[model samples]
Target: MQTLNTLRSDARAIFDAALRAADPRLAVERVLARRGNHLLLNEIPIFDFTRGKLTVIGAGKAGAPMAQAVEAIVKPDDYLGAVNVKYGHLARHHAGVISNSARDGVRAPTKFILLYEAGHPLPDENTLRFTHSLLSLLEEQTENDLVLCLFSGGGSALMEYLVNGITLADLRVFTNELLRCGATIYEINTLRKHISQVKGGQIARLAQPARVVSLVLSDVLGSPLDVIASGPTAPDSSTFADCIAIVEKYHLRETFPPSIVAHYERGARGEIVETPKADDPLFARVTNVIIADNKIACDAAEREAQQRGYAVQVVSTTLQGEARELGHDIAARIKHAPTRTCVLGGGEPTVTIRGSGKGGRAQELTLAAAIEIEGDAELVVMSAGTDGTDGPTDAAGALADNTTVVRARALGMDAHTFLENNDAYHFFAALNDLIITGPTNTNVNDLMIALR
Candidate 1:
């Protein structure tokens, strides 16, 4: 059996490799080099942009790096602007506008502006400002322009512009409630699209005559174009009625803003404009490509495990559900697997916060797995966000071993209580199990690996 420390190291290395493989820069370059300015439809370049004014506009955790990669390929004159990335993720060429000084002989456009960095998992004033700026940019586009949209995870919160009647404060409250309720990304995004002016095909409509090419780094389980970043560039299959249904189903009708309610009601009655459908003319020239996804990350992890001389099995790249329950399931699987085997799973999970404890899904999963795993088989389970941030915390996620339970017991702590309180951050912090890799500048959901 491998030593506990060796297993822990292996888990960390595998997780890091997975994240690097799904890096926006790598994926964007790989896809762009193969199919230049042309839109690759099912591995075939269907729409070639040999002569057109290329304008870049997108928002997400990976927006900066993805933009940087695209910038390397396209001329500086062709680039427009992008927003809402962690600090310092932009390339040297684009750093002048974002930074205190200039570099790479590339000047940040005086017309293009990135408003500000806002809170993650929660939309704040900065989110509102940046979103409005994006909308303003979209409104300026002409029929002759070609828009290259780079989208990844975290764009939902990053691109936050509410409809005329809704306020950012109302959105903040509703988002907190939805997150605490453990709402899925699809459901949350459905509601977000209803209240936002730029989401749910609104951007696509705004860029009406302009041909749009969306290059996406998939952080979602299944790379549904309409679901990623709430499908700002793609056609929206959902409607305001769908949003109302979700709120009603979750018993959040009473808690949501009256404006949100009224807007949906009007939408249902055909008083308000609905999201553009798949067959809409707006998407006649639009193209969406999933350049990378969770599968890429999981596959990279598997390869790393094999290189390290461990038998590897990728359990699933579409793993989802309650964080704690998923932890137990993974632990059970590890217990049954061979001593030299490494089990891996990728995809985001939900945390229904009942307690006032501070924690993200990955931290909670690691904590839960810690409680269930106990043996001398030298098992180490680690969970991390591929974006390098787990919820609003500073740590990427958490790591634990078979001795984690014993360690907690010795510290007079209760793992079940921590899990119940959604205090995985504190629980892992106390044990010094938090994995911190500040702003990886890429996102592909969450990754979990258990080494035996």
Candidate 2:
């Protein structure tokens, strides 16, 4: 009863369920509510609405919708906020404009939070500008104010403020090098914390004297509070020494910008103040809460597959390592899986760029998987990011089945050649198998679904 078409459709359905579970708005709503002139987080009153002016701030792919969720609970003029998101990811309101609209049949003048679009996976001039603006807003807060930090994945790049001597160009160059070197997000963010003015709890420090609460939609596996989006509103368990170690571990000293190297070294030597540590007293007023993560998405995928009559196995939520190797391993597992089984894995995998290839981790994984499942008709694999983006590609990810490589071969494309070149985007595009879902407005790592 499990035909190829059925399996493919079921797999997509399962992934969609996972996306819904990770919806930024719903996730925020689940943890935040207002009860009788007090803002309650998880039923505990954190802010007295009558005593403080509310301000929402932070950045990420989920910033816009997360802001919307907060807006739904608070009055329009009660809070002023700003968030930087990746390009094309915005809520219903136009950027930087306040528009009036009716929600739930109530005519309300919505004070649109400043949602600035900027580059992601890499920082740009707009990233710096937005960070400065956020700092200015933070400076305006007083003890009689409430600050909510809406943070998620991509925030590290979407909201950045360089140190005194480090230029935006320097941060970009080092970031590109760190990404291509297959360094983990933790390691990359360790470096990012040292060079930025507002990361690793620095933002929390800036918003001092005001009660700061962060609602996080985590993209990092294990949802480490200090690692996700470089933990702008959390504590710093990572240090300057860790940053130098990551640079040396990746062998990026030569390629990293000179100012970056100096910055890290200076911080390590205590010439510069380190990021706020876990023991910092400033953290007493700052509370970081993760409302959604990869496990939530993977669990949702499992339930959907089960509803579809699949013997679902959520393999792992902390999936990592080399993308291609993971793909091949997944393909082998699916080959031996039972006829009506669905296997789900979720996490952000790493890809070391050895070639001038143009594909993200998800695409590369699918292409490698295709080569392994070649000529087998009973298996299908789909790997994609929840954020609707994989690396720099337009596609969320790619889909591959037994016929993927065979079809590519017919079209004069060799799977091995493309895999070797890290050109899975083009290879999948040729077969019309790329999964394009532009900016899902959320991030919880990625999901890999395989059916047999």
Candidate 3:
């Protein structure tokens, strides 16, 4: 039988292999190709570059690396595009990042392709500018032009152009309020679609007559195109009525900004046109291809686990609900599994903050598991975000085992108090158990592993 520490090492190695398998560069290189003079996406001819130019526009946490991969494939002179990525993505690379430079501020190879750093998990002033630049680029497109869009997680807050009368302040307030209120990505994006001039297939509308091919890296569970980054290119199935329901569901109708509420009110009343729907003729020229997802990541990890002689079972790919609660449940499952077995789960979970604590969902989940698995020295559990960030913390997530809680108590720390305050980062940091792989440039979702 494998020792507990050996199992922990194996689990982390499997998780890292999963991230490598989901790399955007490989994903793009697999799906996109230039055959002779024609551009093909997924073996289907998307454009005749002889008659039209190949243009690109995209936004997400992985936008920079995705764009870089496309740049390596396409004719440099033929491709002109811009991408909006999170702030720190452009400035740094850690040990895990493959880089030509040893220091920060590494320059990209694409001279014509522009990359802008924007906010994430929350929009900032630069977010509007990023979306506006993308919109302006689309306006320059012609019927013969082909639009290549790269999308991944973190695009929702990275690029946003709010509706008129909805100021940036209102957007910031609404986003902050809804984030802490425990609304799901679907619910939060429902509100965003109604308020944003750039999202909800509006990008497609603006790029009309131009064939749009979107290569998406799925972050949301099940790869629902309409929910990923608020589906800026894919047709939106949601309506203004849906936005109101989400607002009411979170009790943000009254507490949210006034102008924001009024915009939704007008949209609900049909004073403004709805986002493009499934039956809309505008979707005729658009194609959305999900090139990577959480299931793909999980499947890769499962292969790695089995190769190591562990009986592997993917518990769930659509794992959701409270972070702490899920940690407990997954720990219980590990205890029940056969000896030398690995349990895996992937999906973004929500955290309902009961106290003012500093931690991400992945950290909170690991800490909770630590407490639940107390005294069971044969088990190890770990959870991490694929993008190398969990919430706003520098570490991706945490790893804990049966003795984790006892270790904390020996150090005079209360694991329950830290978990309650949503402060798992500090707890794990003191334990020296944080999984710190900075900026993987790929995001499918969170992956959790338990070995018994």
Q: Residue-wise lDDT of candidate 1 within 1-452, one digit each (tens)?
A: 45778888999999888877887877887767435566543466544466545566777888767766765655334446656654444433343465431111122322243323555778777677666665666665667677778888888888877778888888888888788777888898888888877788777787767878888888888988888988888888888778778888888878877777788889888888887889888888888889899999999999999999889878888989999989998888898898788989998999888898998999999998988886546788999998888987998899999999789878998888999999999988999999998778788889999989
**All models: lDDT?**
0.79, 0.86, 0.86
Over the full model, what C-alpha lDDT does candidate 3 score relative to the true structure? 0.86
Q: Return the TM-score for each candidate structure.
A: 0.91, 0.95, 0.95
Clashing residue pairs in candidate 2 are none
Task: Give lDDT for model 2.
Answer: 0.86
**C-alpha-based local distance difference test score of model 1:** 0.79
Ranking by lDDT: 2, 3, 1
Ordered by TM-score, highest first, the candidates read 2, 3, 1
lDDT of 3 by residue, 1-452 (tens): 57878988998998998998888888899899877878888887888878997778888988877887787778556567888888667524323544332222224534566777777777887788767877788876778999999998998998898888988889889988877888888888888888987789988898988989999999998889999989988889898888888888878877899998888889889999999998889899999999899998999999999998889978899999999999999999998889988999999999987788789999999999999889975899999999999987899999999888888898999999999899999999989999999888889999999998
Clashes of each: 0, 0, 0
- lDDT, candidate 2, residue 330? 90
Q: Per-residue lDDT tens digits of candidate 2, residues 147-235? A: 89999999999988888998888888988898899988888889888888789999998888899999999999899999999999888
RMSD of 3: 2.8
lDDT for 326 in candidate 3 is 93
